[model samples]
Target: MNLAELSQLDGPSSELLYNFGLQPVSNRFLSGNCQNSAPTFSLELRINRDSGLIHLGKAFPVDELKPRYSWLTCFEPEDHLDAMVKTIINLPGVDKDSVFGAYSFKDDSTLQRLDYLGYTKQWRIDPEQDLGISDPCANVETYQAVFTPTVAQQICQNHGAADVIIVRHVVEHANNLSGFLESIRALIKPNGYIVWELPDCERALEVGDCTTVWEEHVFYFTTFTFKLLLESAGFSIVHYESVPYPLENSIVAIVQEGKGQNNPNFSDSRIVQEEIDRAYRFVDTIKFRRHAIRNKLENFRENVGRIALFGAGHLSVAFLSTLGLCDLIDFVVDDNPNKKGTRMPVGNLAIKGSEALYSEKVRLCLLGINPRNQSKVIAKHSLFEEQGGQFASIFPGSEVYLEHIS
Candidate 1:
């Protein structure tokens, strides 16, 4: 569909910036021999003029779209979590005795770090177990579950209101942002604090990083938009930081309820124009890059023996499918054992272990993993390079990029 069609589809209050066509649900890793095609939906990014929120044009069903997460913070660098825990604990009225609660298993690493730093009283909300959920399709298994105000009330009733709620990387997946925030507020005590982390999209938008746009994340938040969103949701940002990492940087925010004020800057004409301008640039940059990358891969396929993409994360899925590079890739390599024998969504390419690089004789492997961890992966699979296999970045501007491809 064209721009005109999308604008009409989402209403005039929203401006359509980019359309990613039909993309398969990113995390639906299939069994290796599954012959059925993975389900897909139209992925489009648009900005709401009224709220200044950048979001998806269409909202997919929560149950079908909720991810079976393979991501764990323990596998990542500890510096970010170290800084985050230090920031929250240093806040007044927060101590080891203060209750800490999280929405899912994803927050276990952060809670463990908090415990290490003396905040030992931590509680995790298991929807099925704690909330008495019996249905298999309740969509509570993942962090993507939207905590309504009622759900929050029940949580507070079952296990007294938390002194601090740690919601890491879950807010962006929220289809109902306001409800999600209000629910979290309900779960926290009046004097409690909320510490949350999510991908900072400002850098990605400026550089037009296609990896930042995912089917799972309904909203793409810049620092400005994030603060505005929190304030609008009745929270005041007490502390904020952009934790630097590869691909997308994480936004860590410590906030308190009932302390928000309507910032005049939110409605500034200049700010609105600036957001629109960035959206335009993002569209142009992505369009140009997609064309260039597609051309490069077409030529590379003729010369290169076989191509495999490293990393089966959502970013890798977006990079391949959004840019239509799936057909060019022979298979995807991921270290996660759970994904090794599975299949990627759109392309249905077999997800293989790192050993596939040597066994399959993959001549060229594009790195779709985080740039920070790329060196470690390459070192672990050093034998692949020793056998004349080459590694290159799927996208340009990263530290580990192919001069020819970029």
Candidate 2:
């Protein structure tokens, strides 16, 4: 669909960049065979012309689609938490004795890092205890559901408002983005600051990484759009930095409650148009890569008997679903014991431990883990390579074995 056609959904100022078609939930790894009956949702990315903010269109209800939590922040996608804690402590008003509050389990590692640095007073929201969830995991929902002003006030009443709130990698998953930011105000003292960290989508949008769009992630933010969103929400950006990685950069920002000025850059017609053009290019690149990668995988499957994808994380799920490559892949390999013996949603492809790579006699396994871990994976599986088995990166332009596809 064209931009004009998509603009009708939200407003004239909002235009759809790309529709990922219908996709299954990313984190659902089931023990039974239920892929055929799995639910799907339309995953479309759009841009707000006036604000230059890119977010998903028609996001599924969080309560209905939330999957069982298997990921732990301490594991993957290195956030450099030690450096982040030092940075937060060095902020003007923050110190080792500052009262800290965290929103979700994703902040566990950061909270741990803070403790290691001698931060005395800290608390994290417990779904079972704080929210009085009888069985939190029975009907899963995004943590943002309880991230309300009322809940924040109650927390403050119980223990004083925090001096610094560390929210790591949870904001982007928020469906009600504005309300989530507003709730932070109620949770912190007037003079308190917030430590925010999220995935930076600037490089992903420029490179058109189809794997960037996860069903749970409702918003995609570049550094420019992120600053714009935070400022528009009445928070001043005290400090900002981008931590670089392979697929995307991690955005670290210190913000405080205050009157924020709208970024003047968004008002410039040239800058707004450039954002629109970048989005258009991103859509075009996805279309091209989807077709090219599918063809390459098909040809490889025809020539090579067995092929598997390494890493059963959301990135791999997005790559498989977006490119319609699930049927081409034999199975998925992950090192996580929790994922083993489970099946990926939509394809019902069995998720086996890394040992399957050798026992199954797989050839040409596509690397789906983070780019930073690529070398470690190769080095760990050197025996696979020694026997003439090849490993290819799903990332475009960063191909190792299957360079022709990228």
Candidate 3:
């Protein structure tokens, strides 16, 4: 998995890699039939030269939408993250004082979550600088505003290897997952463990979630492919299970270094075709579904004016392009401090904090995200609902009220 380790592979090892169906991303490419009426978007899903991951194709115009921070902002959920943390905390034999590196917390949320969970305390972060015995160990449980790879590496190399490393939703953004995994292994003690939470690739198909395929995402994953990635990095799977629904379709795999095992059927050609077929089926129908949603929104617009969108996440962009409802939205409402005041990538509507809703006097707010949060959202903004505000969900099949007070 490490660059150095890759160079150490002998001819037979390399040949076995190919025979075992571990092909380099060099063969990864995109090929898909466009729906005659599919709205053009900068994002498209392509095969990763294997069955487990899907790569985003070239940018194309979709209802005047373009890409923004494909790799920067991954837009995941808070509760789901909390659950991942709970999973790690529940893992047996985790050393409390053992070094805990978040690896890629992306923001202070993970650090904050760990603290909130009564795990670790505040630790000042110094970038790429050595920390003495008294200094914070760059642990995921330590709170810090910003963490760069250099800072992370310093922590990885500092003192000794990490006892428990946690990486969440970061693999898809990685250009070289193999190298990253190897690098992580070197940072951990032989007895250390890693917990990785990734969005389930096949779950996207099962739930009819097309937004999962995008340029920012370098790959999608299923257990079969992920096992390949872990084993290739010389890690052994200790525990792996998908998080429950009403939550994102994700897996938290607890791993350690040892002989890696992969499913024999995953490498089969027929199996590969089946996986590709499932992916293509989703992509093919997405365009029509997007268009249909747009029409429905327009229909509702006939009755409701000055509508608002409930979430300013990636789904906001997906909704705008699919519904061409950017001009129709008043502002995108969200609780994330970072998102407020930013403009929706394509919608160009201002990202307003949830508090912004209290003063809007709006009648209807189209739920741009999964309707799952409808009740909580409405309760959180009681004034909005009390002022005769209502919500409509944007799920694929129909525009149902994921939650309605009436």
Runs in model 2 with CA error above 4 Å?
Answer: 1-12, 32-36, 69-76, 136-141, 259-265, 397-406
Model 2, 322-363: lDDT tens per residue?
978899889999878777887887588899988988899887
User: Residue 389 deviation, candidate 2, in Å?
Assistant: 1.6
Tell me each candidate's TM-score: 0.88, 0.90, 0.65
lDDT by residue for model 3 (1-406), tens:
3322322223112221011011111101111221222233333345544433445443222212222222224345556677666766776666356556655435357667777777672232333443332222232212222333444566655545566776777666554445556555665667878878777767666545545544334566776656656665667778887765552467778898775453323347676666566666765556556566556556656776557788766565655654355776778787766566665555356777776666775667777665566667666767776776777665543335422212
Top-down lDDT ranking: 2, 1, 3
Best candidate according to TM-score: 2
Residue runs of model 1 more than 4 Å from their true location after superposition:
1-12, 50-52, 67-78, 134-146, 259-264
Flag the better candidate by TM-score, 1 or 3. Answer: 1
Tell how far residue 315 is off in model 1, in angstroms. Answer: 2.1
